[model samples]
Target: MNAPPEDDLSLGQPNVPATYFKDQRVTCEKDLYKSLPPLINGKAGYQSLLPDHTLVDTSNHADPNSEKGAKIRPDLGHYEHGVVSEEHPTMLDLIILAYEVKKARKEDIVNDTMKCTKPLPHDDCQAPYENTCQTSTITRGQLANYATQICRRQHRTHFYMVFIFHPFIRFIRWDRAGAIVTKRINYVEDCTPLVRFLYLFGRLDRAGKGFDPTVQPASQAEAEEAKKYLKRWEPKLERTVFKMDVPAANGKMRQFLVWGSLADPESPLGRTTRGYPAVEVIDGVVSAKPVFLKEQWRSVAVRPEVETLKELNEHGVLHVPTLLCGGDLPGQETKTHEISIGNWRVGHKRIDKRIHTRFVVAEVGQPLENFPSSKVMLGAIYNAFQGHDQAYNKCKIWHRDISGGNILILDNNKGLLSDWDLAREEADLDNGARAHERTGTWPFMSVGLLQQPNKQHTTRDDLESFFWVILYYGLHYLPHTHRDSLDHMMKEIFDQYDFAERDGMARGGNNKDALVRRGRYLGSRRSQQFSFIGCQPLTEFLFDCLDLLGKWDFRYDPTIQSWEEDGYIPASHAEMEPLWRQALQSPLWPVADRAVDQVRLSKRLDFIVRGERPERKGSKRSDPHDSIQDDEDDDDECSPRKRRKTCHGSEAAHL
Candidate 1:
């Protein structure tokens, strides 16, 4: 099938300097703080009229004579003593008052004054009025939020007794009365995975009261065998956790389910479902047997991946998960054969289990959903392209499916290209030109493939996909307009258009509505939108690629408005390698240099979207980290040009 017209392309001088990247360290703790908003001080702004109709400082009420304290003291008879009078006071009020005082002080110690008081106040003298905070019932959400805030500031040490006095203090009474509610956290829940992992391994608080002894190997021989075999084959194997119980034969074999990851020398497949790390009970002794668990898939697509992985491993590409072992299941064509005791499936399988494939590899690190920096994202793209180069040139294998989810970013700050189930040998392309079925993830698929009917897929299209990935990341990561009229049109085109429609003569295939259509056109249109007007560097970078790809083929001239007749010079990986490398080194959009952290980049981009200059010292270009500062000159109108062209139609139609 003939390819569709190329995207309108314009070549602009590269904006970012090559070889200017600088690395900066980032940790999970810093990222978490940046991502979530800090807790508000419970009493800082909490103000309401006292019983006597006087405004008081509920937050900073440390001194009795202070404005808020002066209001709170007269009721407790502290007007004379500056402390709770021994004569008369309600027990609940005293308890709550003491807690509030302690809260105002931000102290951890439970003052003795908060304990039970004697001689209840006479009915005539008692006010029986509740404090402002205690007048309402505190919901679990409020408590959790306040608790989280306290822990965030204090490093998870203390849980202040924030007594909300509205509607009366009834938490103690409600509990004593056996009222059922969502379980309350008495202390801040420590949910850090590493902390829990260490606790499981007896690395912290080794009391061994309820700890399972089977977490580690039972015998020294088993331990040595595990250490020796894993060291020789998968030296990166670090922490292992016992998962489940496995059925054994005649009570002779002790079987358990386990999963682990690479330790020192990191690998990409950090977390995966391979097989259980078990200590097999043999003839009265336990032995370690780390057998690979391979699943069965209907398509022979996995064969190429298995072969490619083996070849890559041999060449010392250890960042990618190295395959341990693989084989087809026996007895049922594609059905797995019974191997040993610790070889059962852990999770639920589909109705047709035969379509599934299970393979084992040296576990790498966990997958990261978000990137730390645009430089890091570019670094990942760079690494992926290098892998593609090696796979195509050295191994003669072409990865057909390159999507965001397939390429994993590991903890080692490295990107690992994976999930090659749709890959085919390069020889397949050389043999003959044939109409191949449409394949690839929708979001990052090549523009030519989207508009064109059945065509021979090539490595050039895959590289084009990498460009789309970069653009997609910037748009997705950088904040944009919330209620812009342009956004509505853009969303409508992406959400309502059909990307994979086929005509009756051309393969009469099933056509369905999709979230997006005309990938190249959509990208081009967005590049020109007012939302992207200020981000010319990034937009121009993408446009330049379209220009280059179009030029690679003699059939199309993106620079000219006219179409050319027949002769085709299909783009090759070798021809586009330099362009791709240049794009990687080029400067990104505002505040996108590696030196600027993700948090700052997000804020600056948000400001740019609002048609405002990025504020403060961080926006200055002098320091790469502080670059992209707002300029008085950049506060241009936020409307798109009147005749802006779009994917389905011009923006003027919507206007």
Candidate 2:
């Protein structure tokens, strides 16, 4: 992650300016003719065979009656008036006949014939029959033509020819019998290895069952409601799709050629249990639902946008993609032009009717297996944070879901943060709706996210989820067991890990010792360990991340008491300089290293507060909401035994 060597030829020079930090645009069509060389033509002429078996062009303008002219003529008196005659000829006739034969041989020479096979060397093989020997002595050009002729004779059966034009050229046979073209395309560019990995893993469309309108037929009332909602949201959705392209990794063709709609029962998106009838296209058109559910939450609480904004402000920081469009209404068209590669599917097969509503395509540079474990995979996670951080700061957007599935690794090995279905713009950190339901993958949910009235997701929660993702990559499993049932998982997370109490302990303040007790238990040596468990460094990193969440601290300006507090302190700014430098250097390393630094700084700040002179007068009054109070800790807690254990070692590992 260090700056690439200055003299590296492959990297060349950085083209983007420092001030214009945005997604880089790649010309999708540039890879079409990368490897083919120019065509060239050879000489055109004929040759004659002499009496000595040497071949030459024998033509002379001055020797009209001589042997050379006789060879070129069609008739002769001794050889039937310059036409070489085989019977009743004199010595002059014999010479003219031989010359004419040589001239006839010369007229038969071809310039571009392919030699199918070389004659066996005199020492390598027994002498062949005269006729066979003559046939074997063919040119390379003659050979090629002969082989092509043989192929046409034997294999000219029916088959469709597919021509793909791109990074590479390929001719494929579609139907061997019918001779119909099924698909012809050029090599794709801009696709990264991660995208290819996901494709090989399987297209997202195959994740679940086909749509069943018979089972979940829309009620008359619901259908009416949907129609009304669509009318209000359609224009905004169109504008969003037209404004930006979904970042994709496919480079073969700039525009996608979609054949159907997500709303169609037969379409990939409509067949999912939690399906959205929206279609998203990278470079072409996909017609379906306009907005999908913002989160996987079970209930409707606060507006989805409010939660999206809050998360972006706190967790996304700066790398959120602009929200082209989002909402619950169906039947609106949403399009994205940004090309990316990733898999998208909706619903768990076990619980809901499998609906394959989500679709994602990305450009991963090479095959997925070729990616070095730590460099490409882990690097992607790190870069996502950088981009997410940028978007949060610059565009005031937050990405509530920052999972492996949502992150796309581009062909250039850079991670692109995508899936803005749950993104939102924010003006301030503290001003947003309170969502009361849990959403996002269960394995990465923050401890607080598991509690009831699940609407309290924050940047800290996102950080905690990010920790889970890193753990997933390193350990290949969640830190704790998932419940047997989704309901159980939700309950365990919402009720057991009290965010408020853990927050106090994180700040180095006293709380119901239960919070610390839980942390020790989870991180303790006595806990059941799995084979995929990460090494100490990784575990320690996870612990540090948890500590940061407990402390509610951001890496930037750690002196700020709360995210809402706004002031630029020169001293705090100086302290942040090194952190920023570190971030720039390792743009793609997980935030673990930096998260640890933030935790350490938070602890130091707490120490300084405790060590301050009590006699100092007129210190600014601490905001009541910002103050950590030991008395306010909740005593109500859920028993761990009530939770069903779902982690069955590495069986659930996904790359």
Number of the predicted model whose lDDT against the real structure is largest: 1
Q: Candidate 2 at residue 547, lDDT?
A: 46
Return the lDDT, model 2, position 500.
54
Per-candidate clash tally = 25, 94
Where is model 1 more than 4 Å wrong at Cα?
1-304, 315-320, 329-356, 363-368, 429-435, 479-540, 552-569, 583-655
Reference-based TM-score of each model? 0.40, 0.31
Candidate 2 Cα errors over 4 Å, as ranges: 1-255, 258-371, 427-437, 477-517, 520-540, 553-655
Global lDDT scores for all candidate models: 0.35, 0.29
> What's the lDDT for candidate 2?
0.29
Candidate with the greatest TM-score versus the true structure: 1
Q: For residues 520-561, what per-residue lDDT tens digits would candidate 2 score against the true structure? A: 324433353222122333444445444444444333224666
Q: Could you report the Cα RMSD, in angstroms, for every candidate shown?
A: 25.5, 32.0
lDDT of 1 at 556: 24
